[model samples]
Target: MVSTTFEDLNNSKKKLITDALLNEFSHHTLSTAQVSRIVKESGIARGAFYKYFDNLTDAYNYLYHFALQDIHQTITTDYHKKFQPDDYVDQVREFTEKSTNSRYFELVKMHLLFNEAHFSTPVSNHLIIENEFYWATQVLIHDAIKQLMLDPSSKELILQKLANVLHRLAKEDD
Candidate 1:
């Protein structure tokens, strides 16, 4: 997480650093990311980067949180509503397929790749999802997205299966 100092920065200055972080993380995996590049691109001093975050991973995780917030803002689901299966499926497709080409997509891919190695994981980040039905749906959608990444031809089939799976979940509660 970024320090309050970062939060205190002027909006334009903050955007400069955020843009630099985005460009670096979106282009390189965590293993290859360098703070030197971020500082250079943002035109901030090397010491300033450390003042904002603990390290590269800290900054990367902060940006990940920021991106997830952005994703949630665009989500169309009203989970408390009468469980419209179509709405759920569309949300899945948007979060998965449509986001594959997003600027933050590569950074997300890197997180997916290295998520397990973070020894001191937060509760939400842990794999022990207590919501069984929600977990099941997410797992199915995530698997579908993984397959879509390998083969775009699976989109139609994936969409059908996504709807079927969500519909099943919705029906189960009735």
Candidate 2:
């Protein structure tokens, strides 16, 4: 199989459309995401939107890559090197609070809430980064949990149920 290069991946018009689509889809449901609004926000002509993408769903799929890129960065760049279970909880809490200012936080939140078809096309740069981030987090947490099992002092109850805790915190505040 022939390999694709960065030049093949560069599409400025498509990226612009995808960026606009991410903002729109995050603010509204899939059914309600308006192409006109996306075009208007992107400052691109309506025809240009279709020229770059097949339709709204195509646009959304493209936008998913962008959101995944942002999330992958957040998970990897902000992750702690040393596992302090309580510190992990506090960091996630701080992230939850800081998410209000994150441009793509709504998209990330929506992704966690609803199940949908994942973006299928390979986004060469971000896809690999995301895979690495996901696997690294899983491995780190697994090791941490294992270590916690060995030492009572290393274990923190609050960290064990962080997912449930964050969900509850968001639900209560929203």
Instruction: Please report, in order, the local distance difference test score of every candidate based on alpha carbons.
Output: 0.75, 0.55
Per-residue lDDT for 143 in model 2? 43
- What's the distance in Å from true for residue 66, model 2? 1.3
Estimate the overall C-alpha local distance difference test score of candidate 2. Answer: 0.55
Worst 10 residues of 2 by lDDT: 1-10
RMSD of each candidate relative to the true structure: 3.2, 11.8
| Model 2, span 1-174: residue lDDT tens | 111321253588556655677788888776678999999987888876666667777666657665656544554434335433445555444444344346766775665344243433333334356544444444444344344333436345535665444444435444
lDDT, candidate 2, at 116: 48
lDDT of 2 at 42: 79
- Residue ranges of candidate 1 with Cα displaced over 4 Å: 76-84, 97-101, 113-131, 149-153, 169-174
Model 2 TM-score? 0.48
